[model samples]
Target: MRSLTGPTVETIIGVVVRLLADERGESEADVRDELAEGGWELPIDSLRLVEILVQLEQELGVEVPADVESARSMRSVRAFAEVVLAACTTSDGSPSS
Candidate 1:
């Protein structure tokens, strides 16, 4: 396993921004700004969200749960990050910093 340090909210947001930009064919700056203004509700469709989650799982090496709770977490970027961070912490047996 990788020596995983828990990912920060900013890191998760950065990844999400990049993924959204790539998926939507937009610039990262535009996506970032939109997400900043939108806050809790992500601007993408469920399909895009799933694609991003798959990418996040690949990039971060964490298995994001596919249950209802996980779906609820996807309501916001920070919430989603918390879920990923929790997974990382669980896998590495380390407290999230």
Candidate 2:
């Protein structure tokens, strides 16, 4: 396993922003607007959302419950970050049975 760095909200945001930018072939500045302009829902598709979550889980070594109800409520970047931060806060980075 790679040395686990404690995942913080900001850390997750930075990673998500970078990954979103990479996936979209855009700049971080482009992706960071949702955050800078306050919490508006991210205008992204299902495929891109999965890509971001999957990569985030891999990078953080955490398995967010696949069926989280609040996930559906994640309409924006801040919402997404809040969901992720809540997940990380609630668990110890282990697979759920």
Candidate 3:
């Protein structure tokens, strides 16, 4: 499900893993392996999540919505990457024609 005009999920996930690793002082490979196993909860709090999203927006040049669903999606790295991918594809968070 690669977006035609947006960052791929893998790219977003890589960025996320890097950010999480930097925040937690862990290696990117370690963080990525944990996420790859599934059912892994992020150790970050809401504030740190917001900071990551901000960094993502800057790095990816996409505006991530600050909303309930987005907040909920931050529970996992994959989920958050999906949200960021979605944001990259849409101007107002809706499907583009």
Model 3 stretches astray by more than 4 angstroms: 1-5, 92-97
Model 2: CA > 4 A from native: 1-4, 34-38, 93-97
* lDDT per residue as tens, model 1, 1-97: 2333577777877788888889989999998888888874688778888999998888888887777878998989888888887877777687768
Name the 10 consecutive residues with the lowest summed lDDT in model 1: 1-10
lDDT of 3 by residue, 1-97 (tens): 2234456788888888898899889999998788767675666788998898888887887888888878888997878888888888785465533
Against the hidden true structure, what lDDT does model 1 obtain? 0.81
Q: Give the whole-model CA lDDT for all candidates, comma-separated.
A: 0.81, 0.70, 0.79
Q: What is the lDDT of candidate 2?
A: 0.70
Model 2 per-residue lDDT at 79: 63
TM-score of 1: 0.86
Off by over 4 Å in 1: 1-4
Clashing pairs in 3: none
For candidate 2, write residues 53-90 as lDDT tens digits: 88887877666676655576457676676677667666
The numbered model that scores best in TM-score is 1
Each prediction's TM-score versus the true structure: 0.86, 0.74, 0.79
Candidates arranged by TM-score, highest first: 1, 3, 2
